[model samples]
Target chain A: MREINVAAITSCVRQMCMDANYHLSPDMQARLFEAAETEQSPLGRQILEKLKENLEIAAADQIPICQDTGMAVVFVEVGQEVHLTGGDVSSAIQEGVRRGYQDGYLRKSIVRDPLTRVNTGDNTPAVIHYTIVPGEQVRITVAPKGFGSENKSRLFMLVPADGVDGVKKAVLQTVREAGPNACPPMAVGVGIGGNFEKCACLAKQALLIPTDQQSEDPQIRKLEQELLAEINKTGIGPAGLGGTVTALALHVKTYPTHIAGLPVAVNICCHVNRHETMVL
Target chain B: MDCRISTPFTKEKAAELHIGDMVYLTGTIYTARDAAHKRMMEAIRQGRPLPFDLHNSIIYYMGPTPARDGRPIGSAGPTTAGRMDAYAPTLLDLGETGMIGKGRRNEAVRQAVIRNGAVYFAAIGGAGALLSKAITSAEVVAYEDLGTEAVRKLTVQEFPVIVVMDSKGNDLYEIAASKYCTE
Candidate 1:
């Protein structure tokens, strides 16, 4: 068995949080550039150009791309043969978020309680998802999710009769409602199948897929491409002021489910979809 | 329409703006978001003085990151204004003439804007780092404990924003969307 200290995870999480906030992923940036070049609306093109400029400023100055530096959402994949030591993995990851937000000057956006609504002061208690996999290594991904888009995410539990068209209708409806609110052009993360909570997680995890890359599954790839085209036809455009590119890409993940139910979850992300991954 | 304007906007000054006008604002403004707005309203209920002037003043719905060394502010972008919808109409009634934010406002906010002849500007959302470049200086004026959500007095120069909803009730969102929506 490979022994790993939780401290290493902490350090990795810390850097990932800061790095993700400061830099837009290259593939996503390329999408924005492509959108700028192809967008027909004058204002939409202008907005896309400004977004690119915003990314450059964030990277060069090492500041967050957006003030809503977002709540840190982490995904951990641990090899089944690995033994964790030195500290608890959960606490270690939380500590990383706290230190990263504090040291990096990223905004501390978490609240102590949903009811009382007091700031936690340090961004902490990262929403963590874990999986046990094959190798002896631990992989951690940090995606700072901004609430503007997060607030617009939706989950629909459809009866089996709803089928694929139902899923499409649900997604399109969610995106249409999100409109200017989700900060279009958006990257839609869709999860189909699985149980309720699992489907929600899948939607979020789908967002981690490289936007430029397409699903290898031919059917899924076709659906993704079709969705992207239909969404852009929305004319919600760059900042939702109207254009041909409402969304940059759609990341869809599907799994097996119960015979009676069809569950679909859409986790919407704004143009500033910030995420970073590290392995140790 | 590319327009240049300064703050401390009166009803008449604000009325000059129309939906679709791309404006660059230079002058003083205040910042407040969810927590600070609640506190301000609570203070008003308690018959206490507000932290800053409200007359003809513009409030930016934002919560910014901490500034790094030698900088006056950090990445400062508009937050979703809809979150502040509950407080916006009341603030507009109190003579606050302008609000800078992103996203559509509630019907009440739109009504308030027209009733008071106030203007609502849309700052490019997700462009915080670029937006910060326009803010020359920032100082927390109230609710210090609110951290990023504190009310800040800011001096901005050539701050770019678009007139999303104007005093006359023209909404750029509807106007612009109709121009391009294929679906």
Candidate 2:
């Protein structure tokens, strides 16, 4: 069994949080450049150019790209043969978040209680999802999810009879409502065929897929292309100021659901979707 | 063409702005978001003096990240204005003339703008780092305990924003979307 120190995980998580906030992933940056080329509205095109420059400044200056900085959402894939040592996994992750936000000067947005609503001071208790896999290497992904677009996410439960068309309608409706509110030229993450919670999780996980990457499944790839084309055609454009390119990409992840139900979840990520991953 | 405007905007100056006009705001503006708004409203209910005077002032709905070493402020950008819609008309009634934020405001906010001769501006939402370049200085004027949500008095120079809603209730969101959105 390969033994790994929890300190290593903490250090990895800490750096990932800071890095994810400071830099826009290369794939996302390239896709935004591509969107700029096709955007019809002069204003929208200008906004895209400004976004790219802002990202560049953030990276060069070693500062956050956006003020929201977002809540840390970490995904951990642990190998079945590996064993955790040194400290408890959950606390270590939280420690990493605390140091990262505090040291890196990222915003601390978490509230201790939903009702009373007091800032936790340090962005902590990261939303963590874990899975066990076949090999010995552990993969950790840190995606700082800002609530602006997250607030616009939606989940729909449809009867089995409402198939692909239903999913399309639901996604389009959500995007329509989002308009400029969710920050256009957005990335759409669609999760299909799972139950309520599973579908929601799948939708978020789907966002981790690089904007330039396509699904391996031929059918899924076709659906992603169709959705991307249709969404861009909406002309919500960049910053929702009206343009030819509203969405840079669409990612779809599917899982089997019960015979009676079809669940679809759409997670909207703004142009500043920030995520970074490390394998240890 | 871009217009240069300063704070404590007069009714005439407010009326001069129209939907789609670009602006470079230079002067003093206050910052407040959800928490600070609630506190300000509560203070009003308690018959206490507000931390800052409301007359003819413009408020930017934002909660910026903490400043780094030597910088006066950090990445500061507008937050979703819809969340502040509930508290906006009250401030407008108090003679607050302008608001800076992103996203569409509700019917009430639109009507308040027209009725009170106020205007709303849209700062590019995700362009916080770029926007911060225009903010020359920042100081927490009230509710410092609110951390990033504190009410800050920011001195900005050539701060870029677009007129999203004018005093006459011409809304750029509605007009622009209708004009440009395709099937």
Candidate 3:
């Protein structure tokens, strides 16, 4: 069995959080540049240009690309053969987040209670998802999710008869409503065929698939292309000032579900779409 | 058309601006987000004075990251103005003249813009690092406990924005879509 100290995880998480916030992933950058070149609206093109410039500034200055450095959403895969030592794994993860936010100078956006509304101050207790797999390594993906688009995510439960068209309509409606509020030139993560919670997780996972990639499944890939084309047709454009490119990518992930139900989840992400991964 | 303007957003200045105008604004503006706005509203309900007078001042709906390297602020950009829709009209009614944010405003805010001769401008969303260069200085004015959500007074130079809702009640978001829309 491979033995790993929880402290290593803590240090790794801290670095990932800071790194993800400061730099836009290369694939996302490539897509944004492609959008800037192709966008037809003078205003949309200008907005895209400014966004690209912002990305440059963040990287050079080593600062967050956006003020909402976002609440950290962590996805961890642990090998069953690995042994975790030296303190609770959960607390170690939270400690990593606290230090990252405090030291990296990222914004602390979490609140202690939903209604009473007190600031958590350190951006702690990340929304963590874990899976146990074979092998002896631990892989972690740190996605800092901004609320501008997170607030727009939705889950729908449909009868099996509703099928693909129903899913299309739901996604389009969500995109239309999101409009400027979501920060245009967006990435859409979709989950299909799972139950309520599973679908939401699927949707969130879809975002981690490099923004420029296509799904391996032919059927899901076709739907992704179709949705991207239709969404850009809405003329939401860059910054929703109206143009031809509203969404940069649409990704879909699916899992088996109950015979009677078809559940769909749409998790929208702004162009920033910050994430970083580490394996140890 | 590109227009250069300074603060206090006086009557003559408001009249000179229109929807769809690209504005480079300078001088003083105050920052507040959802929590700070709520506190301002609560203070009003208790018949107390606001931390800063709304009269002729522009309010930016923003919360910034903690500044490093002796900089005045960090990655300061506009948040969703629609989230502040509830408090905007009241703040307008109290003599606010200009607002900066991203996203669509509700009808009440549109009417308030017309009623109070105010203007709303959309700063490019997700362009926080670029936007911060324009903010020459920043200092917290109220609600220090709110951290990034604290009310701050910012001095800006050539801050870029597009006039979305004008004093004449024209909303660029309402019309910009049709001009560049695809079938």
lDDT of each: 0.92, 0.90, 0.92
Q: Which ten-residue region of model 3 chain A has the weakest summed lDDT?
A: A207-216
Query: Residue A29 in candidate 3 has what lDDT?
Result: 90
lDDT of 1 by residue, A3-82 (tens): 99999998888899999999989999899999999999999999999999999999999989999999999999999999
Q: Please list the residue runs of candidate 2 whose C-alpha ends up more than 4 Å from where it truly belongs after superposition.
A: none
What's the residue-level lDDT of B11 in candidate 2?
82
Per-residue C-alpha lDDT of model 3 across residues A1-280, encoded as one tens digit per residue = 9999999999989999999999988999999999999999999999999999999999998778999999999999999999999999989999999999899999999999999989999998799999999999999999999999899888999888999999999899889889998999899999998799999999999999887789899999999999899888888888888899899878999999999999999999999898999999
- Top-down DockQ ranking: 1, 3, 2
Q: After best superposition, candidate 1 residue B175: deviation in angstroms?
A: 2.6
Model 3 chain A TM-score equals 0.99
Candidate 3: residue B52 lDDT (0-100) = 96
Candidate 3, superposed: residue stretches over 4 Å from native: none
